[model samples]
Target: MPKQITRAYEERLLRIRIMSHTGDKIHIKLPLDFVKRMVKNNALDFLSGKDDIMDSQKLLNLLINAFDYNLTGEIAYLERNNGDIIRLIID
Candidate 1:
């Protein structure tokens, strides 16, 4: 039988959740491979120091690369003045 190979990027997942004051909620989950592709495709270009996205390009890159370090758990948590909450996790 041929030996099977496992990719590091395939073992990681990125999760995001947002809650609004009006009880609205949103959640997203992405595999690291997809995240990598998105980064390569510049899908995150809007996060590059943009005032609305909060200049998160570097932070996002860091999180995406974190798979190399075998990191998991909450990466970020934010609470807005309007009773909104955002959470980012890696699993």
Candidate 2:
């Protein structure tokens, strides 16, 4: 694990809905600024389920060299610099 800097957007953005033992619900929503930032950074395509999504040369390099990669068959990249890390465990 790496030292994670608590991003401001982490508090305002990305949310998760979880159910407690009491059958309560947790609602979470991603921050607008964070989403905008990611789009500006060119990582926003991952937010949308677009298979034909093609990354530019720079984004590719960023994904490979300066970023952490934990790809298992599918390439799932979440913004590490943003609020609440969201992991959509798909079956």
Candidate 3:
């Protein structure tokens, strides 16, 4: 039988900056483990395609729409489980 796995405490990771040509910038911080999981799950593959690439503007708009209300001026910690999760601290 497989052993049971438990969720560990979430930790802070890296911050990504989204800059626009109008000199506006939005900062988003994500957990390291979460990012690794995303890569492993090919969550970012759409952005890496050469032929049918996702538009940068559309991606940015989606991000902003999803995280606009969660913006923070400073870094913050979030509670998360070991299951697939994506938490963003946008500013």
Candidate 1: residue 34 Cα off by (Å):
0.4
Candidate with more favorable, higher lDDT: 1 or 3: 1
Candidate 2 contains a number of clashing pairs equal to 7
lDDT of 1 at 67: 57
What lDDT score goes with residue 12 in model 2? 34
Query: Which digits, one per residue and each the tens of the lDDT, describe model 1 over residues 1-87?
Result: 976444465676778788878999989888977877888777855334333545577677676667567677788887767787878
Per-residue lDDT tens digits for candidate 3, residues 1-91, read 9764333324434456544445565666666556556655657443333543345345444444433343333232322232222233432
TM-score top scorer: 1
Q: List the candidates' TM-scores in order.
A: 0.70, 0.23, 0.37
Candidate 3 — which residues are off by over 4 angstroms?
1-10, 45-91
**What TM-score does prediction 1 earn?**
0.70
> Which residue pairs come into collision in candidate 1?
none
Per-candidate clashes come to 0, 7, 0
Clashes of 3: 0
Cα deviation of 1 in candidate 2 (Å)? Answer: 47
